[model samples]
Target: MTSHGTTTEECSPTPPTAEPATPSPGLYNADLAPTARKGRTWRSYSIFTLWANDVHSLGNYAFAIGLFALGLGGWQILLALGLGGVFLFLLLNLSGFMGEKTGVPFPVMSRIAFGIRGAQIPALVRGAVAVAWFGIQTYLASVVLRVLIVAVAPGTASWDTNRFLGLSTLGWISFLALWAVQMVIVSYGMELIRKYEAFAGPIILITMASLAIWMFGKAGGSIAWSTPATKTGFDMWRQIVGGASLWVAIYGTFVLNFCDFTRNAVSRRAIVRGNFFGIPLNMLLFGAIVVVLAGAQFKIDGKVIESPADIVKTVPDTFLLVLACLALLVLTVAVNLMANFVAPIYALSNLFPRVLDFRRAGLVSGVVGLVILPWNMYNSPAVISYFLGGLGALLGPLFGIVMADYWLVRRSRVDVPSLYSDRPGGPYHYARGVNVRAVVALVPTAAAALLMAFVPAFHAVSDFSWFIGAGLGVVVYLLVADRKGPFAEASGEAIAVPSKR
Candidate 1:
């Protein structure tokens, strides 16, 4: 019998080579099982490049340059990015530790807190948001791809100008083409993703640096760092805080399911080392380049062009323009796959471990991303706000509950076998395989956060909706669930390290 008191036949298709350590059939599938240490080949540089590509993208470029519009100087904006990066680094570490130690994905780790069946709730919520982002990122990447299409086929200029479903005919072709390519990439699974990210991240990082150098040369090598609207004193501090909050909010989705990648990490040290260079340092370095480019553009054009693709188009050299466009396209795809693709793929796989494997789940996610008509959603500020903010509120609570339960209530002990066990009286089984207290705790906290997002009266504090939900989620879970009875501490070894074999 495998662990969780089930025979190997019931829990998995293949008989176990090692007894007790292997996960069960119902909750355990090859996709969700603990990753073998031998398979954990992602070094710190793999992770660093992952962040490098993730940070250097069209949307991120726009976000960084647009901060000047908020009256923040270059220094203040860099400071804000740094602050957000620190918060993001800390959160990724806390969430990643569970995965690195136990070698499980986020949805699987959630079982320890939400019960086996109940884990589906958070999984589905995260999946929905991921699907939305997948579509949005695909649309954004298509915008850059349109540049290539237009450049290659000058006759398609008419196609670019004509509009349908809020996107031009050229836009549709580009979006669908990029969409198909990404599906093929995901079909190959995680190893391909790791390798692709390693290649894509550093190339785009160099491309952006080159673009910055070109912009500086255009401006005779000297540019003003501060904009005309730069603010100071109390107003500056307020913008700094808001900028920091917005920066963290931008990554709220990745923060929740970071373990999807960390599970492949070779060690806790690898995870930390990668995240350090990947997040804060990389963010600051990229932000600095963005500031310099924006300033140089303002000097030449009398206004900053927020879209990097648009900036690329202004270049007179055909080769550099094509190269920059291709680099931006690759950067967009890198972030989309790394930030938006993996989470939903794993979430859907966990939803029906028996029926859906990685490739199949990726197809489902890709289809959903295509049909969402993401261009419409991405074009609207109010809609994006409500959509992302509402989802962020819901996600924050899940993070809070999982962290609180794992670190505080259970003291990090995980009966790995119990996570897959559907049997009554199993450690994670709870009442009817559902943790009602967790659901009960989730309701009010999520509701409170959602209200902050949806209600206009609460707009002032909506930026902090994630913080509110997470804080309330931790407090409420601790209040309702102590280490006794249904919430008893896990008994057994604290963790079963994944086999090196």
Candidate 2:
């Protein structure tokens, strides 16, 4: 599958004895090294678990069920989700191959395309996006927890009356409680997270299946899979496209920083195998069950309920109610850690390698998540559409530039040590540690994407900002980058990595 150019086959079976032999104060750090082969312990199941935990969250469940409200049938929703899953799966493998081969996280990998110091720009952008989502996820989880507490105690329900900053008094307590729990768990580091994720993934899937079964019985086994045939032709096609875009948007956060997890993978095969089961298969199964639940609920009553937590609240059985709530709590924590927490930690560490380690970076991430007051951002559909959509616009062009630089321009060859060097003529040190071509490509494309997302006239295409930005980035970079400059200088210098051990 690989040769000397643009393929992981060039990677050594084992890493070097001492990768740096000497560290660069500003660029190289212990946390940023290429993972050693011995420490690459993640199997195919680990990757599967990672995606399972990431996908099976309350927000995602609500999203899948909500597509029905858009007038898409069950089969139609599945088709859109299925196509989106395949699209994401292909990209994950492409990026995962790089991480498995190099054993470096996304921030370190960015150095290849963005230059060492210039790498900070993409890193910070990714980190900021993560910060916003972290808060949103945490708040979502807190809402569920508060529901559970109210169900159990009832006295705590009084606290819901008082409001502050768009959240109730109980909401503040619940949010802070979940926030602290996450801070403690994440500070312990990735190994603990890896272990918990493997355990949490299957349990959440089972709980979801159980919920579907109970809801199915509630509707007496009769549920509508499709709405009445209302619109046809181009209008219907537009909904399908929009549904597919929503599916992809659901996973946009992981697209840039998947390498944060894949860097620990035992092999590229593991990543590919895991992603196959984790994404398309998992998404299909999960969507099917969600269809059953939403359909049954609609069958029993004419009203539509989008939030799974709210659906759980309507359950007559207390045991099932408590169980679903707990499962959702675990599911959100698992996703929050893997998707929102880890990426920012790595990004922040990369930005201030001299001042921050993983633990410190995680602390900063938690604080920023709180500061963002994500409850406000998530309270309104308009806010969510503008805020999150705008953030996503930034990443697409960055992804395009990175992928294009690795596969097209340099042909996958990377100078490992030079990435850590600020030496005047170092391979990655292009014009004072910043690649002008990348910046130029990024600014215009990102701006265009933001305009599409924020402007009312561009609403039709706003959902496609990521694709537009990425395509533009690829086209612009290819046109502007110095094809023969760094690639020629660092032609044969494959990475000699030494990661965990």
Candidate 3:
């Protein structure tokens, strides 16, 4: 399955290594599959549970509610969500294919497009973003802890008043505690993560379902979905686009990286089934639950509730409230660790593979996340928008270029050895170990998308920046590569051309 370009080579039909019952040293071993254990197979349902955990989070809840505030009706919002999910599903399938074919992690597989050395560019960018998100999610999880503490022990409310470094004393304590707990689990390795997700995912889903049912009963058996008062100048079309854009931004980051988990699947059918149940199906169900719950809160309180804490505050039963809050807190922490923490750890570790092992890379990323003070990062909406928005722009182009090179340009074949080798004439080798064609396309495309994000006049275009960057990168990379004839020959019959439905 070798492809065009000097780097293409067929993979030997060697079986992946068997998963050890005990933990193994978590470092890149030349003889081992880049990021997969040999024989462990993740079932399709387990993958669905992964998506269930991903979607059932405080951040995801907030994002769904934010879409309603974009001036679209419930039906319109659903349309946007559906459309975005479809786009994300396609992209994820493409990325997941590479993982299935090569049995590599996202950062390692990226070497195919960015060159063995150049892969670090996308890796670092994605890693840095994940770190910021990790801190923010940790902080968010702590908020639920604070609420539960106050609910159960009223006297401890004083801890919320004493402030340091923009966080209350209790806030810092909860943050550190949650951070440590997650570290313990992550340190154990991916098997532990898989186990935790399988358990936590279902619990969160049940809780959310219960919350939705309770809200419905509390609102006199009806839910009224409406925009928040804080939002102004509503337009239906704009809302739809805005809703779709929000989905794209959140899903885009992981769509290209999900292979980090999916590659462990027993088969490609398992990955597809997991994705089917996860993205479109799970997201829609979760979004509907969130919207209904949020809308119910709005009718009862006469104001839209953005935070899960706010909903928890309104619950009457002290014991049930405490339990729910605790569950939500645990759920948030789980999602943060799996989604935000793991991505960056692997991304950064690939940079200095020998010196920085997985655990050390994770610790370094955690420390950097703490230094950033994510609470301050979230304080200003405008600042958060620009920061996240700029990063969002990069995701589309990176996904586009990587997939294009793998499926269209280089074909399905990837040289596993060259991915780690520094030898000249290796498949992934480029001048100075960087692919200028990828850079030439990635830079300007990303810049254009960023400009649309920061500049007010170009704000409308910002929502589709992912699509814009992806399209631009694909076009530019194709022209620059200029090996069209060779691409078809190398691709052979293995290339799965994504239907643009």
Q: Each prediction's TM-score against the native?
A: 0.91, 0.92, 0.88
* lDDT values for all models: 0.80, 0.80, 0.72
Please give, for residues 1-501, the per-residue lDDT of candidate 2 as tens digits.
342222353543223323332447787666776666555667899999998887778778778777787777778778878888888898888788777766778998898888888899888888878888999999999999998888888899999999898889999999999999999988887777888899999898898888888888889977878666424578777777777776776676677778888888877778888999999999899878878877887787766678777678887777777888889999999999998899899898898889888899899999999988899878878767766666777888888899899888987666555677777766778889888889988889888878877888998987677777778989999999889853532211233344332
Instruction: Specify the highest-TM-score model's number.
Output: 2
lDDT: which is higher, 2 or 3? 2
Steric clash pairs (candidate 3): 7-427, 16-38, 17-38
Model 3 C-alpha lDDT per residue in residues 266-320, reported as the tens digit of each score:
5666777888888888878877787788778777876666866677777899999
C-alpha RMSD values across all candidates: 5.6, 3.2, 6.6
Candidate 3 at 297: error in angstroms?
Answer: 2.4
Clashing pairs in 1: 11-25
For model 2, give the 10-residue run with minimal summed lDDT: 488-497
Q: Write the per-residue lDDT of candidate 1 for residues 1-501, one digit (tens) a residue.
A: 123222222433332222333355667776777776555677798878888998777777888888876678789989989998999999988887667656778888888888998999888888888888889989988877887777777788898887888888889999999999999999988888888999898788899999889889998887667778889898898788877887777787877888888777777778788999999999999888988888888888778777777778887877777788889888988999988888888888888888888899999999988887888888888778777657767988888888899888876666665676787767777888788889999999999888987888998877677777788999999989857643332221223334221
- Badly placed stretches (over 4 Å) of model 1 are 1-24, 161-166, 380-383, 485-501
Alpha-carbon runs more than 4 Å astray in model 3: 1-38, 225-235, 380-383, 482-501
